[model samples]
Target: MCSYGSKLVAPWTIASPISAKICRLRQVAKRFYNFGSKEYKSAFGDAPFFDSQGLRERTIQYIKNFDASIWHKDPIRTIVKGNYFIQGVESDTTNAIGNINGKQIFADKETFEKITAHISSSALRYEVSKCKDLMKAVRRLEADLL
Candidate 1:
């Protein structure tokens, strides 16, 4: 087994010139912070290859997204005044008619959860079956994992 500090470097000194060049390329790639699809580890590696800074940004964003306002109160059962406001195209006609119950009514958290729960699983199945080929690789399989 290789040690942490000298593992890759120690191998580089002993490796052939071609191997050394490959390792050097990997070293440069390891330093990259690109949040793009070109990311890899070994030649045919997986997606979601987060470097140190990318991981840190995601960690901070997770903490920043925590709802402090919800800490004191229970989950909402009815629509609040704040929930009534939906941000969309801002126009005089839209302002007068769209908000404050035009055709559809905004539900509170509890109601929204209940309504979604009824349709969620079926709706997801419908969506997946619609484009089965495109989503085949990532979508969950019926077979057990080895």
Candidate 2:
């Protein structure tokens, strides 16, 4: 022990409030890391979002046509007709103007055309539409799948 005025300080003793707080934090972090090293429940537990097998399959299939180099999995929150869905981002770093519920995905014809344009050229065929039939058909197909 060393004397600082009338107080005797031990080598292992925390000398200040900040050091005491830091020691407590290190103990907590050690416990947390040790617990994490053992088998543990998932961070999200069993959320419904992780259990959607059908939706997962469909999303995978649809995204397979997209150009991986130009687009990545960036979830964007969207609401349509009072319902919410997680959309994606466009190549231009803009929110993809679309919404997909349990049923069909919906967007304006222009948005739909613009997003689909990001499909890999090898897998895509270009079309110039004069009407809304294409988007309607896409919506119908999406609805039928669900």
Candidate 3:
């Protein structure tokens, strides 16, 4: 009789196809953000504001749109919201994910999910908005997924 080990194999080994597909998508997104099209740059560039309120409004809209577009394909795989900067795991693939002081760290799904849930629930969004650094905030969120 054949005997199997009690330990469960990692999901990556069990679901190579899904893992590979996610990896590919992540790569493409990263490439697009890094060497993005002219339009992307223009959309994110600094703009003279008519007023502080107008600047805030535009920034909020831009951030929401940017986030929605990036996570549109897989909402579950994305960090929809957050408060204080923290790191965690993605729920689906157990990818390591987080943004430490603005740098993204993607590890495993379990870890990413924990961190994502925590930050998403915290006052990170308010704090981030107050800083008015939408690009850094967006980058922190996107880097984890990618």
Candidate 4:
């Protein structure tokens, strides 16, 4: 995720040299502060051949079709994290970023679980899904471990 002004923008990283170059350029041009740049890794470095199974495209399509209400009262936010977010990390599920209602919300996995402990599984799923973009980035980070 790149911080554009006060907002965060996440671009799915395709497995290609061109995409890597573009990501590098984004880091320089837009001052996009992603885990890749922070760890001296490019987007490609994080997700080498990630789309080998067409999972990226399929996942995007699935996300588009998946019913947000089935999981929660609100829609899923659709956070897409590339593999770079987890480079060199063993297991980190505590980082979260997104919004709920009009207020900006941020929390880690454990904290999120505790905060919404009272909510039903479906609603919890929706709230977590709402942070899709952040979770996507988190998944990207997890890819580095693979």
Best by lDDT: 3
lDDT of 3 at 103: 25
Quote the positional error of residue 130 for candidate 1 in Å: 19
How much lDDT does each candidate structure score? 0.46, 0.48, 0.52, 0.45
Question: TM-score ranking from best to worst?
Answer: 2, 4, 3, 1
Full-model lDDT, candidate 2? 0.48
User: What C-alpha lDDT, on a 0 to 100 scale, does residue 63 get in candidate 4?
Assistant: 91
Model 4 C-alpha lDDT per residue in residues 1-113, reported as the tens digit of each score: 64445656553544565655676687787665556464545333445455546887898899989864443343223222221221121322222574323222244565445
Please list all clashing residue pairs in model 1, or write none if there are none.
none
How does candidate 1 fare on TM-score? 0.20
Model 3, global lDDT? 0.52
What is the clash tally of candidate 2? 0
Q: lDDT tens string, model 3, 1-146?
A: 11124554444454467755665666677767845577765657775656889889999998877743334244343343433322444332323564222223344666667666766665355336665457766676565434
TM-score of each: 0.20, 0.24, 0.21, 0.22
Best by TM-score: 2
Q: Residue 104: error of model 3 in Å?
A: 44
Query: Model 1, range 1-146, lDDT digits (tens) per residue?
Result: 21235563543574477766766676677678565545323333444655999889999998999764442233323332224333223222123556422222245566567546644553455335454253343333222111
Q: In candidate 2, what are the lDDT values of residues 1-146, reduced to their tens digit?
A: 43345776643575686655666676677677745433453432343645589888889988887654433343333443334443433223333565331232345565555445533432234343576336444554444333
**What is candidate 4's TM-score against the reference?**
0.22
